[model samples]
Target chain A: MSTAKISLRGVHKAFGANSVLNGIDMDIAEGTVVSLIGPSGSGKSTLLRCINLLEPIDDGEILLDGIDISLPGFDANPVRRRIGMVFQNFNLFPHMSVEDNITLSPVRTLGVNKSLARAKAVELLERFGLADKVNAFPDQLSGGQQQRVAIIRALAIEPEVLLLDEITSSLDPELVGEVLDVVRELKTSGMTLVLATHEMGFARDISDLVCVLYSGHIIEQGLPSQVFSAPQSERAQQFLERIIRAGRL
Target chain B: MGTITGRRAAYERARKRRSTVVATVSSLAVVTAIVVLVPKMPRWDRVHESFFNGERFAHSLPRLLDAFVLDIKIFAWSMPAIVVLALLVAITRNSRSAALFPLRILTIAYTDIMRGVPIILWIYLIGFGVPGLGIERPWNSPLIWGSVALVLTYASYIAEVFRAGIESVHESQRAAARSLGLSSWQTMRHVVLPQAIRRVIPPLMNDMVSLQKDVALVSLIGPIEILRQAGIDKSKFANFTPYIAAAAIFLLITIPLTRTTDWLIERERRRTTGTRIS
Candidate 1:
């Protein structure tokens, strides 16, 4: 836990009467990818949101670099600055051009100079094979291109941890590869990543640790090879069996 | 295929021509009926003498146009004040901090009270009531107070428009902004307001058009704007022709503004859809 880049302990969240994340505890070691896999409405997205501080926790501590960030009166802004998030909907600012979208946070939040931020944006866009799209608006780009730009926008701030919430879930089946390719590149570059995703094969390929959530709890957490192959808890086994039955694993 | 397409083109052209002819004929009929039937009424002579006397209209036209300049002056100056104050009020109302809760409540009450009162009553209270404090010359001038009334009342309405625009933005966008580490104020300034202001321009222009006409209400407090000048001309000439002239003057300005608003709205619609109306 001391070496963990992110650690969650007894985290709980609920909306009205519906409890979402119940007593979650996990440690994400530095420079490793952690994949959260679960059925829909199983609190995967809620857990990612709580970690990013987009959603406030009802109880417990989320520690970043040994600091208890979820304690009351802790400023979430500075913590969020250290954690970048990409959404399923690719919530890129529609009114801004791709260049502007990528540069906005760096320029405004980090006080980076405009020209310098823009240079970083151009470099990221070029690396993603989207150099021609710098002047284009989000609506003008394909879903794949927009999601890649979203990743670049997050990377522009150079956050220590990146949280991806089903980043490729909204892309066309054919367009999914382009986005996943970026995630593959990120893995090689050694950024600590926590992603809530439904792509079972991609999760198996890239994640050092896989956590299978059911209802609102971590039902299983282990190496992907162990969880994907061996018989384990009844619920985890049932989940894998269903995935195999559906030809998704 | 060529012949078929040619025949379809001819059919389309014929359809357009037929519609145009029908529209023109119907419009002509309405105009002709108004012109011919209006004079046939029993009191047409008296009504014509009072309301449509061309000589009286000509006599009052120059004074009404001159007084209309005051309306324009008041409008031009009041508009900036209204827009600035309304944006401030709207942003104030959007504050979410527990510390700003009282300030937020104050803004809500401000908008409620300002919007609940009629513009005329606002003009009377701020215009007459303020001047009644006997502040002496230029400071107590009704023009200044009347413009202030216009600013306050219109700011409330525009602030509500701005609030609606702000709320129309999806919560996801806020989440996206916050996730990027933008402070709430930064989120609004950079991500939210740019979109909100664009979406609300048509409504804001509509409000401006209404304000252009409502400037006349200021005449009730004491400034001899076009409406008041028309009243003065009415008593002197014992005819209502000046009122028509005043209406004509207002239409002259508002018609172009209304058309420009429509053009802007259509352009925005086309922009969002990325399609031509045709």
Candidate 2:
């Protein structure tokens, strides 16, 4: 518990009249992978965004490295530097070259030297098998390649926690494997990842813990095996049954 | 199969030839009608002598061209000033800082006032009213004040253009930048402004074409730019050809510029994806 990389306590978030996240609590330990799987609009993305401080929660305490980052007027930049997010839409900067996109945050935010940042970018691109695309713009790359580069861009900042929000949901069926492969690689590297995903099989294979959310509540969470094989909550059972029927589980 | 392909190619060629012939014949008929029928009007000689007199055209061309250099200089200096001021105002208006709320209001007021007033009235007020303040020589010159009026007026219009460009950038782009730990200002400078400026170049160029022609407006206050010089020539020669010569020079520059703007707009349209007409 002391080593929990991210801790959310009694979190609640609402947009105007519709509540998205409600009275939720979770602790993600260091160097473990957690997957949040739920129906669309079930607060998975909202929970991830709250942890990253992209959206301010209506009421909660989000602790990152033992600091309450959800406090009023908390400077989120330094916090965000330690937590990376990969979006559902693969929001890569279209005007920038792949290499530049990866190097920008490190150079601008971290004050890393330009040449060193670029060298690191090249190494990361090479590791991702995107060495030849270092100078290509995002529009020139396929959806899979762009997502891979986005992962590389997130990695360049060397974040302690990575929050991925349905990163593979937008890719073509044939292209989803490439990005999932990168996630699998990350899982083996001991990075703490919190993913909101629809890829049930991949989530089951990689996640140490699986959380089932319904109606903005984490109805069940436990070891992936326990959650997948025997969901305790009725809502979790119904949700998993639908996923099973879709051949996703 | 080869015979079928050859026949298709021949058919395509015939269609192209037919369209080209029709276009050329229609254009020629319009030109011939204007050429033959226009002079048949009773006062054609008077109209031609006043407007298209060969001697006056040649006589006024050199002086008008010389005066036009002044117009070019005014346009050149005013454009950069307008661009810089407009960008600042646009960014100020777009800022989300609570501390900058006053600045945002100021920018809104500035743009509203500048745009609400007619450019001519501004030229008169700043051009005459400022000098009437008993300012010293050189600084009091109408050219300096007149150029300032043009800059202020045009910057307001251009600022809105820039603001439109800024707003057009997707909010997700800003979120992505912010999530990367870049400060809001850094996000704007690197991620937003570059894209915004690129998107607005076509409209910005259109504004510049208008700005170029409106440089002639300064002649109303003073500074013997082409239009003013044309007046001088007309009074001296007692003919209106100088005005026509001045117009020709403006058309020579503006037409090409207008065409270039269209080309850029077309190229930009082709580069992006979305709903497109066939």
Candidate 3:
């Protein structure tokens, strides 16, 4: 059995009695793509954010590498460094160039020298097919290009796990494939990825394990082929039917 | 069809004729008014005499130069104090702690009070009140007192300028930095403050220009700056030439600075737009 890179048990989050995430329990295994598919506001993004401690869970244990992250006096920054996150809106620093954006956290947090950081940034940018646009600012890049840069930025610190929150949802139809290509490449490279996406086809193609979230609960989870081809739960079937009928799956 | 075309032509002609009549009447009226009013206006002889007279110019030059140097010294002392105080005020104003709320409120009240009161009054209060209290006036110099008054008064305004600049930084910029695993201070120092300071530069330069002009107001406390020297020369020479010469000198110093500031504002505006585009 593969080791779990991230484990969540009895995770609960409430925003002023709304109860956005209620009792989420899941395990993301190392070196595999696990896609979380759900409707909007189904706590998919919240779960991903919790793993990075961006939104602190109200009640739950987030175990990263079999160690509880919420334990007293635990350093959240190092944990955050280990768990990279790509935001839905890209969240690229507008004032910084693509190279600076990628190199920033590494230099500031890890005390990496500028020359080393720059070389690393160039390598990542080149791998991401953005070598020529290194000096360009965030606003200069297209949505797909910016999102790719954001992924490279997160990956620059050599994170053990990466969380992608609806990364392709903001991209144009034609631009979506370019971003998905990067994710596809990451999956092939044996990176542990927890992706929250509405793109059913991309999820089915790239994910090894697929989990369907409904009303803050993982209603069904299994192999991507099993979940996509034959869902046992009525909720999963209904969601898949709705998504297919809407021509989105 | 011919009649309709003729009617259109007539309408166009009438419109052109009406505009011509209006323009002609306005110019004729202005010329007539100028002709009637020219001699009734104040004589240029006073202005001419002030410029040509050597005795008055020479008498005022010494006092004007002295006053100018005094003004420069006062500004030199006050500027650093204002920059540091304003930065402190900005940080306090932006702090999230509950304890910082009262400090923020007090800062706002202080700025408001300083802006409302006259600087001359502040100078007198500092100069005379300290002597009355047996403090022996630390510097015992009007230059020092004037500078103190200027710094206190302008620091309040500068603080507001800085606070506005800091607040103008997009909230998303801060969030982006935080998400990168940077602490609050790290995000502020690295990302937010750099952008904020850039945005505030042109306005800060404007404030500096205002400060230069405001230095003259210190003459009320008897610092013997350019304005003070001009006043003394005017009285001694029994002519307004010295005052005119001082005014000329002020213009000579300020006009270039004003042009430079305008150019800077335009350049910054272009850079901001360029950044937005990219």
**How close is chain B to the truth by TM-score, in each candidate?**
0.91, 0.90, 0.76
DockQ of 1: 0.61
Expressed as tens digits, the lDDT of each residue in B1-278 for candidate 2 is 99999999999999999999999999999999999999999999998998888999999999999999999999999999999999999999999999999999999999999999999999999999999999999889999999999999999999999999999999989988988999999999999998999899888988999999999999998799999999999899888999899999999999998898788778765554334564
Error of 3 at B10 (Å): 33
Q: Score candidate 3 by lDDT.
A: 0.84
Q: What DockQ does every candidate get?
A: 0.61, 0.55, 0.30
Per-structure clash totals for the candidates: 0, 0, 3
- Candidate 2 residue pairs that clash: none
**lDDT winner among the candidates?**
2
Q: Report, for every candidate in turn, its global Cα lDDT versus the true structure.
A: 0.92, 0.93, 0.84
For model 3, how does the per-residue alpha-carbon lDDT over A1-249 read when each residue is reduced to its tens digit? Answer: 226888889999888979988898888889989999988889999898788777778898989888999665577777888888998899887767888899999999989999999999999889888999888877778899999999999998888899999999899999999999999999889999999999999999889899999989999999989999999999999999999999987
Expressed as tens digits, the lDDT of each residue in A1-249 for candidate 2 is: 466888889999999999999898998999999999989999999999899898999997999978899998999999999999999998998878898899999999999999999999999999989999998888878999999999999999999999999999999999999999999899889899999999999999999999999989999999999999999999899999999999887
RMSD of each: 2.3, 2.5, 6.8
lDDT of 1 by residue, A83-145 (tens): 999999999988888899999999999999999999999998888899998988787788999
How much is B26 displaced in model 2, in angstroms? 4.0
Q: Higher DockQ: candidate 1 or 3?
A: 1
TM-score of each: 0.93, 0.94, 0.82
lDDT-based ranking: 2, 1, 3
